[model samples]
Target: MSIADPVAVREHLLAAAAAGHPLTYSELLARLGHPFTRPRMRALCKTLAAVDDAAQADGEPELAVLVVRQSDGLPGQGWWTGSWEKHRFTGDWTGPDARLLIDRLQRQAFRYWQERAPG
Candidate 1:
């Protein structure tokens, strides 16, 4: 679960992706000379998204991504119960791949709980 060599995996994935090759879960792990469960791959997807600043930037470093209810202007501004509440995960959610994330990073219990709490 612990990604002792995340740098290597990241580099390999980037290289493979840049080479016009789409890496499957198994392919990615194989390239890393390791075997991981499917959940680990999902967690890696989140991890990659979080760690890669380029993926999060929108030409402005000052503005952080915000998630608002699609059905309403914002939360708690009014009695708006929106059907679509949007929030950026930002590598906080444990998701269904919780086990993998926990294995990689140990101090995720509180974060995972907060993500599951009623908003």
Candidate 2:
């Protein structure tokens, strides 16, 4: 699949979710036959979020995608979790301030998702 192919990506994600097999970022990219890259991943994330919104209009399950940095000492070492239900994120943080910011963002995102109508 082309890296620009959001339709294919969304289809794969929905299939995986329906099969009870959620995908990590790497796994999702791999399934889409694309190599991992920051830009591609970001685009995919955006696309998946849009897909979730569309699905919401049809009363389909939402696809929740979460990306977090790892504390393994490797810069930019992170992974993504994608599922049909929202997942709470809690782990090492850059600092207390960063944690607070993340919390606020997460809460805002949750509310947005909760109140969004299919568009």
Best-matching candidate per TM-score: 2
Scanning candidate 2 in windows of ten residues, the lowest lDDT window is: 72-81
- Over 1-119, each residue of candidate 2 has an lDDT whose tens digit, in order, gives 86456578766755554454345666677777887787887776776666756766876555543333334211122222333134344544356644564455444444544455333
Q: List ranges where model 2 is wrong by over 4 Å.
A: 66-119
Error of 2 at 64 (Å): 3.5
Note the residue pairs that clash in candidate 2.
none
lDDT of 1 by residue, 1-119 (tens): 33334455555544443342334555555565657575655555444444334423532111101111233212111111211132222332323442343232222322333344454
Alpha-carbon deviation at 30 in model 2, angstroms: 1.3
State how far residue 83 of model 1 sits from its true place (Å): 19
Per-model CA lDDT versus the true structure: 0.36, 0.53
